[model samples]
Structure formats: C-alpha cells, structure tokens
Target: MHKEKQQNIKALFPPRPEEPQESDCCGSGCSPCVFDIYHLQLLEWKKQCSDILCNAGCYSKTSDGETNEPLLSPIKFSPFQLLSVQQHTHNTFLYLFQAVRANSEPDQESAVTEYTYVKRPLGISVGQHLVMRCSSDGNQNTVVTRAYTPISDLRASNVGQFEVLIKLYENGKMSKYIQNMKKNDIVEWRGPCGNFTYMPNSCRHLLMFCAGTGIAPMYPIAKSVTENDLDDTFVHLLFACRCFEDILLRNEMQQLSLYWNFSAEIFLSQVESTAESQTRYGECVKKGRIDKGVVIERLAGKTLQQVSILICGTKSFNKDMINYVKHVGVPDDNIHLF
Candidate 1:
C-alpha cells in the first residue's frame, strides 16, 4: 500500500541525471565528481550511446506479414472535455478533469509530490466523484465513470485537473484516439471512480507489487505514508519491467530513502527487470521478478496482520501474484487487489 505511494513520490521529484552546468549531482554547485550520472540523463548523446542507457523494451521480431498475429495498433483515447490542458513535455500532456460525484467525505485528501502540479475540481467536495459523460469517437456517448481515489494534492489551486497515466496498447482503440487529440478538442468525462483506495492506519507495513503503467495508484497511497510521517511503518515495493532501462523515475525513487518524517523512512526498491519472454518465470523471477520471498526475508518475523499487500499488473500477472500470496497464507482481507 505504502509502496504505491512511494512510487508516486518518485513521479513527483524525479532526479535529473545531469545538470546543465558541471555541478554536483544533487543539484549542488560543487563541481568535482566521481560519477557524472547527473550529467548523463540531461544529455541526448548519452541516450544514443549503447553502453549507458536505460529503456523499457525487447527486440521484438516484427511479425512477418504471413503470420496471423492480430494487427496491433499503439493508440488509445478516453474523452475528457476540453476544460483545459497543459503540456509538460513534447511527448507528455496533462488534461484538467471535470468528473461526476460518487459520495462525500469530511476530510478527503491525497499526498502529492513537489512535482505533482494539478487542478482540483471546483465546487466539488473532497471524496465527491466528478461526473462526466463517457464516450468514444463513435456514436455511443455513454454516461459512466470509473472512481479514482483523488490523486490530486490539496495544495494545488487549479480546480480542474487530476493525474492519469495512459500508455498505448498494441493496436488499442482508445489509445489511438488519445494520441490524436488536438488542442481545444472538447471531450466529455464523468466520475472520480474506482473502489481501490488507501485507508490510513490499516497496517504498519505495506508491500506493493506493480508493473509497467500500474504505478499510478501506488502514488497517492504511498504519499499518505511519507507526507503524514508514518515513520514506524515500512513500505516494500516490487516493480518489474522488461529491462533496467524501462524503470520510470529512476532518480526519483532514490529520493524516497529519506522521505517525509512520518512512516518508517521508506526504503524504495525495484526488481531490476529483464526480458521475461526470454526467461521462464522461475529464472526470470529469480533474476528480474523481485522475489516476494526476498521481501518477506526483509521483514523477518513480521506478522501478516501488521502488513497489507497491494497487487497491480497486467491481467495475467495480477492473477499469478494474487494466487502466490494466497498460497503463502496471507488472508484475503490483507491483500488489496489493484
């Protein structure tokens, strides 16, 4: 649970690999250095160099035209009305949201990273879901919304934005439409949806299991631990990926070692991933899987009641993990599904 939040923190204050000026990697002015990693991330050339680079992928053999594989497209679209939009990078876009209400809560808030800048929906109470009319490019403009445990921080004054992580799926319909969105494209949306939420004081220790693009929910939960100063508790996170290069917010994860004073100083970790397709689960898990046993070993003698688990991944991966934990005797209540 907390591991999810810590990942969010990483998304917030991502460490830059290099500073433009020859300063210390910690954004310090000190010039002399041993390893200039801070200098590297900032370099377009370093990325081109094969020796020092991190990316998320494998050398997939392009399917022969003769093959019967489903034609895959890497595009997705979920309509969000043109309330507003912000461009963070050439490739990154942030859309301010107007969603539907689910219910009401007295004190609904989320932990946010310094880098997490967003708009809060105006006139909407915390915990109240923002309603929107859901639709695709076609004729069916359905009114339905998924509940999102508000990931926006209270500090942000913009009463319109929420954080969302959308990755292109292979020949995905919604993915394709999102990639095609133009400025001022009016989109209709509804609801801060999802039953998955982090309740405070549920456990002193948390283990979060995640995969590519599954890191979104992990953020708000982890933030609660760090920002609220849950120092007595521990957060163990297992993030698996295809290769070490695919790890997101690599530098930001490093910052979590000493996070907000609450919670036990969070120790953030990731399973340095490898191409799972090339390696069987047994071997890959031993190497790239970020062994759950290792996590248990790290928590030696800790009671399962004292710790809760959160699992998020692809449909197939999630099934396998949930079963493994259940087989290990973890009660159903303690294991939160993502």
Candidate 2:
C-alpha cells in the first residue's frame, strides 16, 4: 500500500539516490538544515499523494472507446443518485447508486434524446473504495467525506451500479447522513481508493482473518477468487463477530461455497454454541476467540511459501493476530495488515 505513495512522491519530487556525505554537510550551526527540510517536505508529499490516490479511478475503456483514461476524472467529485436502499442486517444497510455526470447532454447528431436513467459506470476494482461526501448543515464546502469499499462485483458484468454495505452507529456522521437519505437523493462520490489488488492464481491458498465489519473488503476478494474458478486456488476465511446475528452476508457466502472451493468459520466471542446455532450454522460456528490451536489445525500441512494471509479488524485484533502468527513461526513477510 505504501508503495503507491513512494512511487508518486518520487515521480513528482525525485529523492536523492544517496544522502549527502559528511564533507558535504556544510555545517553552519543551523537549528534545522537542508536534510531536515527535505524530510518534512517528503512527509507532506506523501500526504498529498495519498489524497490523489483516494480520488483516482481505475484504467478502463470508456463509452467513447478511449483507453487508459479514468472514466471519472479525479479533478471533481461526481454526483450519484440513490436508486434504492435495503436493510441487510439490523444496523447495516445496502445503498445502491447511479452515477449522474454534470453537463451530460445528448449529442446534437441524435434526433431522439432518450433520458432513461441507468446505473453509472464506476470503473473500479474489487478491493478499491469510494469516497462519499455529504453535509449536515447543508453547506457544500464544509462537507464530510467517508471511504467505503463496494461489496459488488463491478467487472463481473460491467453494470452501471455498485453496492456499499454501511453499518449505522450512534453519533456517526456519515452513517447517519446516508441512512436518512431518501430515494433519488444525489450524493457526491469519488474513487477507486486503496492499494490491495487480487490476481487469479496469485497464490496457492488465500487466508483471510477479519472481525466484525472488517469483513467488508474480504467479501469482494473471496467473491472474485471464487468467480475466477482457478484450478489450484483455495480460500479460507476466519471471521469473528460478537454473535451469530452479527454475521453479515452469511447466505451469500454459503451460496458461493456450494460450487467453489471456499470455506468459512465464524467465531463468536460473546455466546456459546447452542442447539439452534449448531443446527443452523453447523460446523461454521465456533465459540470463544480465534487461537493458535485453530490456526495451526487449519494450516497443518499447508506450505507457507504458497500461502498469503490478509488481516483486517480492530487495532487489537490485528496486533494480536500478527503476534500469534509470529509465535507459530510464520515469517513476517507472509502476514499482511490491511
């Protein structure tokens, strides 16, 4: 992920191949010298570069047959209308939106000007995010923005719409704003953020560790890998939530596993397995927290070189999982934090 920042900074402001030698220091008892100034500038450059990426779009051919250009420019946030909203869980809602470009008038050559509204083209990928901007006081300039990854497969059918799964929380600015939105309400959006990319057959097996709503990005990843149908590809997901009710996309995941080599284990920290959960969830449900015993048993004979683990959760979940994996002799390079 940091690679993009480094590349952008170097392209815009090239860094010195090597630091200045002792003889070139030119000491003048200055409080902060040229090197210090350069370091500060580099930090600023990184921030700016990250913002640019947050608003960048994917490379794809547009309606006009142009390639290698963003379908939506990063110069401005595009307007998208809320086509529909559905409650996915107790607190999570799925918002579907259609892109409506400003000044999108029909060509003069066409006699019939059809104004049918369709889903807008996103030109985004599986793991990329969309930055949504809205206002609480109805002030456009003083707006608040939030980043959300689309759980929909945009490239699967090149549809004009996308779906985002958002969880509502008390005192949550963005969530509250989106939840209260009515049908056809226009929301400002921009994107294709994040640097995680999934390629087919990239690894022998993919291990995903996510907790709570952190499963957002993992959904698209597992979907993409399974849809690709690579012969040697396999996926294992260790998802931890508070209880069975908190588990999101359970039906969709189970449906996918019916035809793909995908397996998921749901761990609950607050409840023990009951007869109801056992009958409903079967072997997928487990009590207590994810531990070394679980990890080791699942990864018994799997080759480390061919396995890559993705970690996404709260700060503590990430730290604890990383430490636990390290304790089991897994190399630092095999574990990735998202």
Candidate 3:
C-alpha cells in the first residue's frame, strides 16, 4: 500500500524543462525571450508539484477533464471567436475577438429562451502584449506564433472583447494566416505578457518612438494616461511612416492630441510635403525621418531623471531610436523596448 502511494505521488510530477540552445534564440530582442518562457514554465511546474503535495494527490478538474483556467493565461492558450474584421489601411487590419463561453446555460429570468453570459474584461495592463498561434493549412505540424499588443481602451467597461492591429507583410508566415481568416473563425490566444509596468503618474513625461504598426503598445499607455482625470503624465509621441496615409490609428491619435498633456508628431520619410498634405496634417507632420534633432527638441524642457523613454519598431528602427536617445544622456534603465 505504501509503495502504491509513492507511485501515485511520483505520477503527479511534471517533466522538467530542458534549457534552450543558443541557436534557438533569433536574437531580435523579443520581450518574452525563449529563456524567459522556459523560466516561467519552470516556475509553473514547481507550483504544480507543490499543489499536488498539499492536496495529497487530489486535483481539481472541470467538466471537460481540464483544469479550470482563466480567460487569458501565460501557460495555456484560450479560444476566441473572430467577431469582426476591418481593414484600416492597405496592409493593416483590425480584428475583434470575443471570448468563447464555457458551458453557458440559458437564463430563467428572461421571458425569451436565450443563453445569458456575463462579460469579463480582458484585463490587459497598459503596455502589455499577447501571443497568437496559427498552424499551416496543409501541414498541421507547421505552427507560427507572433506577439501583438491590443489597442483597445483598458479603462472601458467589461465587454468580453479586444482588438489587435496587424500589418500584413508580403512574405510573412503569420501574415498569410491572418489574411485568410473569416468571421467566426477561432483563434488561440494567450497573454497579457510583458515586462513593462505603467503606474499612474509614475513619471513626469513619456517620450514614445514608434513606426508602422509598432504603435500598438504605445497607444494604450498614451490613451490611459490622457483619459485619466488624476494622472498628469505628459506624452510626447514621435510616429514615423512612409506617408500620411500609412499612419496607423490616425483618427485615434488626432483625438488623443486634443488633450492638453498629449502631443504627437509624425515623420514622413518617403513623401514630399505638398500644400494639401501640409494643410491637413498641419505642423504635426514633418517631411523627414526622426533624427537626433527631433529627439533633442522633444527632450528640451524635460529633465532626464523625470522622463521615461519607450521604443517599438522594426529591428533597425529600434536600434536607431535607442542610440539616438542614449546619445542624449538618457540612461539605459529608463528606456523600455516593446
């Protein structure tokens, strides 16, 4: 009987994770690195073992024989149905996903027979991102995963929905999968994963640099700060794109700019400034790339200690922005990359 008990206890232990090889890392400076994922998995395994010991081999399981999980999790993916899709630009698309209810039942209080569901907020923090996975059509074994930050307002009431903006690359694997998605198609998502934390009024000023769809993470933080009545963080945003039409979230940015504390400037690298373009975008649009001069101008009145820097873009763009900021005396600790 003792020997059987020992075997039962041993069966509850999960296999230990193997450390990732150096070659496994793409070295693009991903937020949750392969090493980071391994560490999180290790911590989860330890907790599971501890729980098993405390419960004396008993474990809780839902009706489907799976552990009851949260709407979003770092360890497991949850299915969300594609409620709608909108094309924002030539290549950018906005997707809205609704959480799939688990074992929903009809409400007896209502005269009509319909399933009533309680909406839950996505619970995404200001600057966090989520990961999505897709499998190739022909080969189910071929899976591609990418990280995206949602642009939905975090302060809004619970709606059981969230939106993500994606730019379809010509030859991107994930882009191909997303482009073919239809309404009601199910997608697997897991997240609210990121290292950066934004506390209300944590800093006097926020200097953000983004290009293309990189504005995803920066938008939420800026929106939260500007909308809050008590938070007085000044936001200075430098957005870069090929042309005025290429700017993602143009209307939303324009709206946010109405706030006294929020200011945004767009850098057009490819297009020549025309009379109509200048008139429409006004003084906020510049006809060049974001260089050291622009960085200096944004940082003119702010002290280094009270300012926080945020950067999100392609590899080269991120490198350039980081170098530009560091050259201007901003310390490494104050800079955050997403």
> Which candidate achieves the best TM-score against the true structure?
3
**Full ranking by lDDT:** 3, 2, 1
Once all C-alphas are superposed, what RMSD does model 2 give against the true structure? Answer: 10.3
Error of 2 at 217 (Å): 0.9
lDDT by residue (1-338, candidate 2, tens digit) is 24454355335533323434556657996658665654466445545543443343233345655333344444468777788899888988888877655445665687433233433356676667788889977997768898887888855214456788888888898877876899878787888777666544545788899997778888888887676533357988899988767888888778667645788888889885634534364347778888878877767788664577888889999988887777766656557777
Comparing 1 and 3 by lDDT, which wins?
Answer: 3
RMSD value for candidate 3: 13.7
* lDDT, model 3, position 251: 85
In angstroms, the error of model 3 at 23 is 48
What TM-score against the true fold does each predicted structure earn?
Answer: 0.53, 0.73, 0.73
Clashes per candidate, residues 3 or more apart or on different chains: 53, 1, 0
User: 157, model 3: CA deviation in Å?
Assistant: 7.8
Model 2 TM = 0.73
Error of 1 at 238 (Å): 1.1
